[model samples]
Target: MIEPSYYLSNIVQELKPSGIRKFFDLAAGMEGVISLGVGEPDFVTPWNVREACILSLEQGYTSYTANAGLIELRKEISHYLKNLTNIEYNPHNQVLVTVGGSQALDISLRAIVNPGDEVIVIEPSFVSYASLVTLAGGIPVPVQTTGDMEFKLQPEELEKAITEKTKAIILCSPNNPTGTCLNKKELEMIAEIIEKYDLLVISDEIYAELTYDEAYTSFVSIKGMEERTILVSGFSKGFAMTGWRLGYIAANPEFLNAMLKIHQYSMMCAPTMAQYAAIEAMKNGKEDVIHMKKSYRQRRNLFVGALNDIGLTCHVPGGAFYAFPSIQKTNLTSEEFAEQLLMEEKVAVVPGNVFGKSGEGFVRCSYASSLEQLQEAVRRMQRFVESRT
Candidate 1:
């Protein structure tokens, strides 16, 4: 048996397996698991969006599109961003579609990061950031945020993490695991810091359409931040199109070109049918997004309040569908809390520590499930807490 190359890349060796996946794996094989662990929306893709994709299939649009994705889709994305976020970009050269926001980040990191370069990441962020940074041969500098601050990163934290080697800061607002959003003033402060230091920024606005209290702010909307920021977004969250595998990146031509080259080699193009569908999504998906956002907000309130009543001490997340609640009161580590809840109560929530060290003593509960599920989860959690008490 040819031992598969004894020397795997150090980048691969240094990475820790996903903390979320371990629980998911166990939950997957078990029966009667009610999971709030996954971050995906519970809704199906909008009917019209699905129809658009079917139309593309009927038209024989299965071949690979241009490396930068369909020109038509880029134009739609450009128009969509302009209408919603006031961010402008040329569809011709400023955008490159990818597998999802996840791959877009991977491509962007590969294009920009050199070996030993430092990439500042806020925690607890989505799981892919550090992995992508490692794959791109960059060092991931994790800056931990706290529940007290609603999990928002402070300007001072960013300042403390920066050094001569710093290449970029990854911003994920309406953040994963925590559901924290950075307000315009907060984002402006970060933009100021980045501009002052002349560092690049990768703004992952994948959950841009999911905000509750205020409108989503695009970094590109901030003056001078556009040139320095690479915006990453997709149809998954907004249009409930996760399985479509469609997302795009917008940046200046130089950065776009670099990502296009990597994308050309790695993915060749995003799914042609998905691109066609995305065009429809961009043009007509606003109503779909609004409907979903309204539902999410209702769920958010219900779940947050319910968790609080159950003695979880959850923050009222401003955006995204997750509720990050402390497990500390029960005197359980995040893993222990989540595991016992699953084993005894049949409730599957992700341990916050899976996202980062900062996520310790909390668990992330996604409220994208139905109201019935949310009600049941809260009842079970109440029982679990009472038992612990």
Candidate 2:
């Protein structure tokens, strides 16, 4: 009989299963669980965007698109970026649409990382970074951020983490789990650090459209950083198109060319119907985005206020729909807090430790559910806190 352990790749063997999934599985089978665990938008894809997909199917536009994605969609993406962020890319050469920002990240890592090369990731960040870095044969050097700084990455922390083996920094603003956005001044400081080290930057701006107070800054828009920065974004969070599985990476032609090799060979183009729908989202979905942002802000205020009133300290999130509240007052570990909340309060939240060690003593609560659900979850949480007290 074949030895299955020997057949498994050593790289796969070394990777730990996702920490985020542990709570998800526990919450799954439980009855009456109100989950604020996942980071997906609560909105449906706008009716017009969904119609666009149906229209494409009606038009018999089901054949495979070019590996670089549809030329029309690429043009729309370039125009959208230029209009909003002042970043320019050629539709033909500098963009390769992929299977969501997740795929863009994986393909980018595959393109640039070599075994043992260090990739600096800011925490608490999106959970996929370390795993993707490892899969690309790189080391994930985490730079921890704190609640004192609203969980924003400090330039000094970044400076301490860098070494000669450092290949790239994965920058996520309107960061996941924490809902922290880096302002222009903060990004300028980061630019200085990047220039000093001559490092590559993979800026995940998937939540670009979700910033509450500040204009989103693209790393490529910074002076001298454009040539070395890869911008990863898509329709998932902002456009409520997560199920469409459409995302793209924009970089210099050379880097784009390299990424295209991996994208083409691995996944080819993103779904054709999704690309068609995305074109509609880019052209006519501005109002939809604004509406969603307003709802998220309202939810943010309600959730954060409830959390603070209940003795948890939560930062005023600048972007994204999450509230990362410190549960230290309860004297429960984040995991313990989360598990107990699930069991007793029947409310589901992600433990901060799932994001990183820096995330300990906190819990990530997404306000993406409805106003009623948000209100009810907060009520349950308040009762839970009182019980623990």
Candidate 3:
């Protein structure tokens, strides 16, 4: 019999499985486990959003939308971005609705990347960024950011990472795993480097609505960035609409058209009901987003405080619902710390190493669970830390 490797693409064969999923699956099989591994919202989709989808079904409006998606939904996305970022995109040509922010990321990379092109991915970041770059036939050059730097990409580091072969950079503010939100000043500094390098940016702003303390800044709103940035966002994080799998891209028409070709052949269109639901989300989901953001802020305070009190030093995350606390004091590799914690205390978290090499001494704990569950998880984590000491 032929080896399975002989039939598989070399890229697919060599790609490692998602590190986040490993613990999630282990926690799934355990009893009394409190999982802080996944980065999903704990809230349900707002009633109005769901009702809109239901209403669409009742009206017998289920069918594949136009390849770019429902024009009305595109218009809503345009209006939403305009309101949030103060940047205007022509709804007809600049917006492309996608299955999820993940798909938006995938197609955007595919649209821009060519073989041997290098895409700079700031680390520790969402696992998918590097993988998607690789899958798009580009070299994923990871540039590390440490907790000392609050995990924000520095302009110097970015400049060092770029070469003539560098095609683009992926920026995820209110970042996954680390929860580092870039402020306007910090973004402007990075924008200067981007301009100097003449590089494109695929800015993932899926967590834009979850910022705490300071307002979120859209990268495209920076002077001279509108044409160079591809904005990818979705309802999954803020609207608590993960299952809806609805996301959209706002970019220059040239980029949108290139991505649309791939999206047309591969995805065809986003789910019709989800598109309808997303329309309602954009129109009336502000209150829902605000409520969820407030709850996450409270949870962040509780969870990060508890982790620090237990000797795991954690930075105060400015946005998103994750706390990346240093586990170095425990004298264990990130994977070892996560694994032992799960087996001993029945609390699950993603090892920071899974994110990138600079993430080796930390672990990511999501604060998107209930307060009660977070409290219990912290207690268990304290116990686990105490035993090692």
lDDT of 3 by residue, 304-376 (tens): 9999999999999999999999999989999999999999999999999999999999999999999999999
Q: Candidate 1 or 3, higher lDDT?
A: 3
Residue 60 of model 2: what lDDT? 96
**Alpha carbon deviation, residue 387, candidate 3 (Å):** 0.9
Whichever of 2 and 3 has more lDDT, that candidate is 3
lDDT of each structure? 0.90, 0.92, 0.94
**TM-scores, all models, native as reference:** 0.98, 0.98, 0.99
Best by TM-score: 3
Could you arrange the candidates by TM-score from highest to lowest?
A: 3, 2, 1
lDDT per residue (tens digit) for residues 1-389 in model 1: 76655667756877899888988997898887889998899999989989999999999989988888888889988888897678778999998899998899999999999999999999998988988998899999999999888899999998999999999999998899899988889989998999999999999999989999988788888878989999999988878999998999999999999998888888899889989999998888889888999999999998899888878898888888899999898888999999999999989999999888999999999999999999988998999999998
Candidate 2 has which clashing residue pairs, if any? Answer: none
Model 2 worst lDDT window (10 residues): 213-222
Ranking by lDDT: 3, 2, 1
Estimate the lDDT of model 1.
Answer: 0.90
